[model samples]
Target: MTWGVVAIAGVLGLATPLLVRPLLRRYGVADDPNERSSHRERTLRGGGVAPLLAIGVGYLLVLALGNTAAVGTVLLLAGAAVAAGLLGLAEDVRGLPVMVRASLQLVIGIGAAAGLCIAFGQQWWAAALGALLIAAYINIANFMDGLNGISGLHGLLSGMVYGALGAFSGSAWLTATGIVVAVAFASFLPWNLTRPGLFLGDVGSYVLGASLASLAVASAMSGISLVTALAPLAIYLADTLVTLARRAARGEPVLRPHRTHAYQRLTDTGLSHVQASLTVSVFSLGAAIVGVLIPLAGLNQWAGAAVIVAIAVVYLLLPRLRGSRLPRKPQTALVDIDRPAAIAPRVDFYPKRWIVLGASGFVGSAVADHLVAAGHDVVRLTAPRLALMPETAANPISVERALNSDDFDALVRAFEGSDVVINAAGRATPDSPADADLYGANALLPAFVARAASSAGVARAIHLSSAAVQGRRSTLDESLDTSPFSPYSHSKALGERLFLSFGSPDGETDHVVIRATSVQGPGRATTESFRHIARSFVASVAAPGNQPTVVSSIDGLVDFVTRVGGSSGPLGPIMLQPWEGHSAYDVLSAAGGSPRILPRWICTMVLVVVRGLGRVIPEVAGAGRRLELMWLGQDQRSEYTLEFPAMPNHVLVGILSNREDAS
Candidate 1:
């Protein structure tokens, strides 16, 4: 059954990667990241072996079971795909000359065309067209494999169209081949969706294109409409033809590798590899859908032509229009965080290109603005789920990894050709209370950044660490030994160690770690704070809250980064905070809330009650624990030595003022 054939192919497709990845790596089959490469690091190549192998095995099973009129044509299709895939594999392993490659492709295409003509009892004219189209499609598929997920999705969608057409035309061979190809690609998608995953490579692309071409050619031989047969591949065909024409007009080297394709252009402008690939795949699917439905609907020739033209026009224009609209100014306010008098100003230094990680986060966004405002070339790295605000979308760099994982290779790519790499990404809140989350972000992430910065030959790497690493010390300084008391603090301490260690080996990478305290800004406010104390305990809480102390503002943080960046000073760890700290209650009350104060005994009674409730309610436990810290704040108060200019007496008002101005 067709279902059984597809299911078998899908299982093989999924399993083949696991079997072949090690072999490819062992055989030294690797693709080095180049100027035109979508990936940042050198990764294993020859991933196509898996899917090609799957398709071959599936073809044999289908051939054995199916006794149909198109069996000889199906045999021709399988032979063509195998021949093309082998040629591609030869090119991948050992360099093949252009002439040799072309001669081989032509041989395979012509052979397939002759066989199809004989098997279908068709004329010489059909054979000539089939040969040309098959060869062309083979190359087009190879060209489109530059980005991740493009080839896989294209094969899947195109296969669907072919299967539908075959069913309509009552060709069992076409239907079986299409189903097998679609299922194989669907199974292989996960391995190609993210960075550090396998690519289809030349071999896989050749197999896909050849298989699809064979289906189309065979369909035409069966008296199916040529227009319907080619409709599924319209987007790919159009892009390939247009790119070829443009290159020829400019007299460029057409056979050489280049990044001028529309999809590549979209990536260059701001789209990620996945984003660009998906755009083309969706448009192609839409066109394929029309191809299948319009004939069934019996639309007139003129109307069908109009529909096809409209789809082509829209697909060609969408990327260009989207690229042109990316905003230069960042949506988040950077000026609000820049206080001229708060920290040292920028000294005389050359403006350097910078790469910023986690640009969608509160601190990262401000850092990006600071770099851009200073007229430095900044490439902001964003995750899949996070979109760059149009205000700051001037230019973007694609990092294919998600935010949570330790995708260090993406960092290396982003860090390439940059003078400085700023890591403004990390977990700031403890609401989730997962040790894995804290350790992954605060500890492991900085280590990854350090390695990437080193690998990219970056001049400097700055990491924004937290003062929480020191726990509740009264005399906070850089030299004081860290005694982290919580998961967040522990992770921060470990991260600081890892970052600082990067400079110890060979001293090539200048690493700077800033331990910042109580960073507050418009969006920097956290949900992880003191809660659930009785009204009677308010008085005791108010005393510690009102203690004079320094606070770190978002503006002060940015000023420190810029000034430190400008200086030619030696890289080392620094603790930064405002010179004066407003009492915790004074800062809290200033935010337009009625102050509550309670006696010490009442506070103790509330803590006991809250602790009891915390057994059943974890949230209550967190609240009760925070209240205990507030009660013990005076004992833990510290005079931090390294300081920036004081924000102001009315800190909350000044913060609001700064926020309003940025808006």
Candidate 2:
């Protein structure tokens, strides 16, 4: 009959979720995973309704069957559990202040304890102890609900202990209540363990805590040993106290929603949610055997205490040992351009499938190479097959095929399953310098990519912009408004605006614009890379002691790419600058040359003469303009500084010098 009641309760628990799941979805009561969340996808919340309903159904059903033994106690305790569950549901809908929430919990806990004391005819001291124990259990259980399957496993394990204690002590009320609590959570476990289906939320956790605490108190008041009541909960108590102490010692905000609990740390140390949950459940089971079953089997108090100490010792060392065994990845610093509060700092990122537009270009190729070398899956989206320049990888789709199709069919086809879509394809130096080409490649391409990325459910879409967008600033800062001095700068600025204005299809997709100063590196050679190359030549030939502007190294570009690309945090727009300022003359001087510093007027004259010569030399004017900008440090220095380790001024220049020497 007792097992039949448990089965009936389990059936109700299973049925409740099927009903509640649809309601939650219809009402949009879902949980969107954030930085502190373990799951990656949004899922239904408030699955606590399952267990809460099941317990209520079981209580009424048992009473209807004329099982009147301890019926009053069962009703009273179950009512308190329902009240606690409602309070948690209220919090889920609209957050309550900590003081209000905690005060309410105290009232419910103390009220249940007092009720148990009166029913069992216990003394005032017993009432006080019950209140304290119940309150502590409620809160500890609440704190322990950080991971998936943990709360359910805890509910199952602790329920079994209380149920067995009730059976042995011959309290029908305790036995029935324990069975209801266990069976309810057992029914909910399948939904939790299989996929990102449902979360217990605050409501479910609160009810679990209240139910378990009240059961413990009721049993103890009914002549069950206090040790037996506490033993099943020993693991939870220890973990909570230890974790709380650690957080307090570190001066962390105790009330904030953070993932720092021992079990959370276990997950961080490479244990899956299932593993962490099972580990805690296993400990709770061991504790029940030593503290409850062994005592029932006539073991002495000292033996139980010794076993508990062993459990505590194992709990203390488990995370540390497991963490040590796991290989640690190098931690990367996450930086936000302006909105620090909006961004989450992280050390590691899940490897993403990335699609690089303009895979043949300098910035595109460099970023694509880095993504591949770092083990991310990469797809190179290039020009049409007939217009295709040469391919290097397994996945290559032409730009015409990716972009020119109707209804974004081809774009969606190419972007499907990509986590990040990077639009690195832009023409900084067009052959014709036509407005149509400039606007099409720089502005329109980014806008199209942003739309496609959003439509395809990509998490992040990055569009590379040039520092030239804030052209000719005396002291360039990230906050500086765009000041396009030339056609190139104007187009780049327009491109940034287009990407930024291309709002997310859903609020979850993030768009980033990277405004980078001159990037000088190998791979796909560009005017910027050649300008730096020419600087080395100028350093080797020019009269010693002359200085020119600062340029960002290939290493600097790669560093910036890694930081921005790997971040699963908030992002908008950022500007990249040189690690430190150095003159082209300084670079040449460092490269074993005594380059004479030319007067500003002389340098201007040289540019004018080079431009005149470029009219005859065809591409000389464009090449000269690029060289002049490098010579003058592009007439801008970044207002915002990247927080990466600064490379020595001589290092980049020396690298350039070595390359120059090798050639």
Instruction: Give the candidate number with the greatest TM-score.
Output: 2
Stretches of candidate 2 exceeding 4 Å from the true structure: 324-663
For each candidate in turn, the TM-score is 0.49, 0.49
lDDT per prediction?
0.68, 0.69
- 154-216, model 1: which lDDT tens digit per residue? 888888788887778777777788877787787788888766788777888888888888888
For residues 523-589, write the lDDT of model 2, one tens digit per residue.
Answer: 4355334445554545332223233454556556655665676675544454555444666565444
**Residue runs of model 1 more than 4 Å from their true location after superposition:** 324-663
Q: Return the top candidate by lDDT.
A: 2
Judge candidate 1 against the unseen true structure and give its global Cα lDDT, from 0 to 1. 0.68
Deviation of model 2 at 267, angstroms: 1.6
